[model samples]
Target: MDKALPRTIACVTAVLGLALALAGPAAATPGVPAPEASADGTLVSRTGTAVTVTAAVGLSNTISVWQAGDTIRVRDTGDTVTALGGCRPVSANEAVCPGAGSLTELVVHAGDQADDVTSFLESLGVTLVGGAGDDSLYGGGANDTLEGDEGADFLSGGGGNDTLTGSSGRDRLFGGPGNDSIEGRGGGDLINAGAGNDVVSGGNGNDQVIAGTGNDFVDGGPGQDTLDAVDEVGGNDYVRGGDESDTCRADLGDSVTECP
Candidate 1:
């Protein structure tokens, strides 16, 4: 454990305050922070070195998690929904949000336990950051992001074109149904860029990368990794196996860089 870390992790993240629903596993290390769950709902906050984010669930039950500068905040309420993309919710479930969505960043601190997060509504880019456990994080709407801080984690970009980062451990990363980007920062990893044109990197481990169905860029970085261009359509993709001895598969009209 890094003593420099704030020493807190997220247990689970609610979907706009759905904390009562996705309660998964315990922290790999104790003393991590997670929102409390009760009939009345709960409010929780975690602070890191440079950022602080809060999570909440209220009686009215709508979650709001966003970042302001370096300070990120989350609040869930049954009585009121937070103004997202400059549109205030007149009702809990109903809001005439504009087509051009506006939320840029959201922050969540998951514990070292296995956890999950979800959001549905407008294309507000949400960011979910996981802790030390084998966590699972999901991104929603337009241009979202998910980061698995430690442990064997799973990250999926749900709808919009998004970015997924597997920070450590043997993690699984999936890009969305849109043009996406993914990174396997360390440890052995499995990466799949699901749809549209994508960019991927398998960093510092023996990884299995499947560039799915698009003109994509794949980099098997610093390990004996396998890079596969699983291009089903008539698409050309690029693959590069970095550092160690690697295996690469590509189709015609595709570019290969230092990969065999």
Candidate 2:
């Protein structure tokens, strides 16, 4: 951690607020105030220094923390963050942090984790994605999407437009932001929506999904699945698919999708 950077990490509680505060680093161009992070969200800073982040518990996924000057990508293992770009040797094990190009496109991709990576982000007040050993994901205040390739993963879209995919795992997903999308490709999965128009899909397994508080779309691709709209307002929802024995419940002004 650098001594000049602020000690307090801002944890953003809302995606829209984060977007309004800093309109993506991509637009900032060169020679501007880099995106400064706080426990509440991103801030404006013109300093170059390193900050040590203490990891939080019960939060899975890898976080890519960015600054205008430079970055130090710390991996749980040497191969934890695959495809590392612009990382130079800093010490025997640590390397110089890589720049995230632009703020609009802050890319921090996590490959696999033996534990929950969310705690690290929460402690540091950042948002990120990657593999989890538990396969269960809890979303935060940033617009994030996650995928679990194995095990039964549970995911929540805390805020912002999010996309979640549980590939090859029985998963649970929740959409809690801007029009969100979810896909569960294996095992039985569950999905829920909150405060935004959403699209959810289940594949090759028995699944349960609900569209709550927004005009939403639910797609139960295969196997015995359940779709319900007990907690939703105007926007209209679509429920599609029927494999083996599937059930669907809806209200008026909602679209029911049953495509064979």
Candidate 3:
């Protein structure tokens, strides 16, 4: 990454006297590939955030705990991982981790357990990949991207306009208070575009879409999907059930077509 990460992380170590001792990029694994591109930001954390920060993708069934300066690889057995980025534990799910690299976007692999991975409030355009267990992935107050890879997952975008994608398992994609875009890539999914205008797509399964109170667009791609905007206080939403046997319901200010 040519861009230098934000300098905030250096401040944390200088203030706390923590043993950051940042490491160079770990040698790449045999078959796994490095990330295609990297975004720039410091990696901070909040409490109750599952899945430790990572430098590598495609990890499985393990929490990759790296140090302040360590490359984002899974912590080897002999590698010493400190206390929540060397700050003392605040709670059971300790966070407030302070670290950063050249890239800010993330492609997580949180393994087979349920996880709640939330980006820092200062982050933007982060991309996370959840695991096979029910997970909740949240984008912060800026434009971000998240992918629910498997299991019954929940992807929510915060105040900034964001993008949410789902996978083969049932999912809930919520575009929070910003004008956002979301797609249920697979499975029987629930797409809720919560406040602000949005674009929603049910990729390839029986889906239920809730376009909440915004001038929005909904597309049920290829299954018996339910496009619902029946609330009285809803906005003018355009609903479409693609070339499939689907159900499209809406209010007066909305327009629906192509259900047949």
Taken over the whole model, the C-alpha lDDT of each candidate is 0.60, 0.50, 0.58
TM-score of each: 0.63, 0.57, 0.61
RMSD of each: 15.1, 15.4, 16.1
Best by TM-score: 1
Worst 10 residues of 2 by lDDT: 40-49
Give lDDT for model 1: 0.60
lDDT of 2 by residue, 119-167 (tens): 2222122333444355445555556645555566667756667666775
lDDT of 3 by residue, 185-238 (tens): 779999988887667878888999987866666778888999986657433566
Residue 194, candidate 1: Cα error in Å is: 0.8
> Candidate 2 at 152: error in angstroms?
1.6
- What's each prediction's clash count? 13, 33, 6
Any runs in candidate 1 off by more than 4 Å, and if so which? Answer: 1-104, 232-235
What order do candidates take by lDDT, descending? 1, 3, 2
Compared with the true structure, what per-residue lDDT tens digits does model 1 show for residues 1-260? 35422321110111111211111111112222434433322223222222223323222233344433433344444333233333344454333323222334345554445655554523467667676667767676667767788789888887787768786699999886987777888899999888776778788989999988756777899989999996753225657788879999876435566875
Residue 95 lDDT (model 3): 30
Q: For this target, which candidate reaches the highest lDDT against the unseen true structure?
A: 1
- The superposed Cα distance between candidate 3 and the true structure at residue 139, in angstroms, equals 2.2
* Model 3 residue pairs with clashes: 22-69, 23-69, 39-103, 39-104, 40-104, 55-72
